[model samples]
Target: MKVLVAVATRHGATREIAESVAAALGTALTDAGVRSQVEVRDAGLVHSVEGLDAVVLGSAVYLGHWLEPARKLAESFADELGRVPVWLFSSGPVGEQKRPAEEPVVVEDLVRRLNARGHRLFGGRIDRRTLEFPERAVVAALRVADADNRDWPTIRAWGREIGTSLARLERSVS
Candidate 1:
């Protein structure tokens, strides 16, 4: 099986999350003795999904919306993606809440368009030092707090679930 893990990030936080998810998926699939190829890419750079068996796509959420590149990827590849299993994730939410301030506005539409198997909302990271001037202003204006709330164990478990499902899919096809 071949899997593509794609992400859209701002300030590299969501990229790290995507990497972690990819790594976890690779490990889980390998440990299960499942034969597979996994590749991680920036959403904007992935132009085709021709040979992939499954896809896991994620994006940074800002002001309750996915970043444009991630959204555009789903829009552009909806037909191809619908032919395979796809999972979506959103990363952005800080502070004690440890959940998104709101669901990303694009998720529902993408889920339907892509025929996505599942979607997850993961807590995000915020660093004032990395913020551009306008981002900083928005953060300050919104009183957003700084924190890294990504749950590694949960992420790993989700990856394992995907690995298991793919293994079953491979079996059924074989």
Candidate 2:
């Protein structure tokens, strides 16, 4: 099995999430006795999805919006992506309090355009030291503390689900 995990991240939090998902997915596929090759790449750097059995695409959400690179990737590869099993995820919404209840505005449209099998929303991390002007100012204004709010268990479970799906798919085809 061949899988691609393409992600667009700002300050690398979303990338970390992508890595975790990739790791878990790889482990699960191994446990299922399905030999697999999974590549995690920057969404902007990927030019094609040829021969990929599945794809997991994700982006970092900022102010209810997905970063431009990810959106462009989906738009650029819509036709090719639609032919395979694709999953989507968004990483953002950080706080000591409850995570945001709203999904990124563009998620639904991309999911439909790509015929994505599912979408997940994962909590994000904020490190004040990494922030630039407006973001730092905004964090200061909102008094949002620097923290990593991502839930590993849920993220891993989601990855395992995709792995399970792929194993079933492989069996059906064989």
How much lDDT does each candidate structure score?
Answer: 0.88, 0.92
lDDT by residue (tens digit), candidate 1, 55-100: 9999998878998889989889889999999999999767678766
- Residue pairs clashing, model 2: none
Give lDDT for model 1.
0.88
* Model 1 spans > 4 angstroms off: none
Tens digits of lDDT, candidate 2, 122-163: 999999889899999998888888888898999999999999
Per-candidate TM equals: 0.95, 0.96
Residue 136 accuracy (lDDT) in model 2:
96
Q: Pick the candidate with the highest TM-score.
A: 2
C-alpha lDDT of residue 164 in model 2: 90
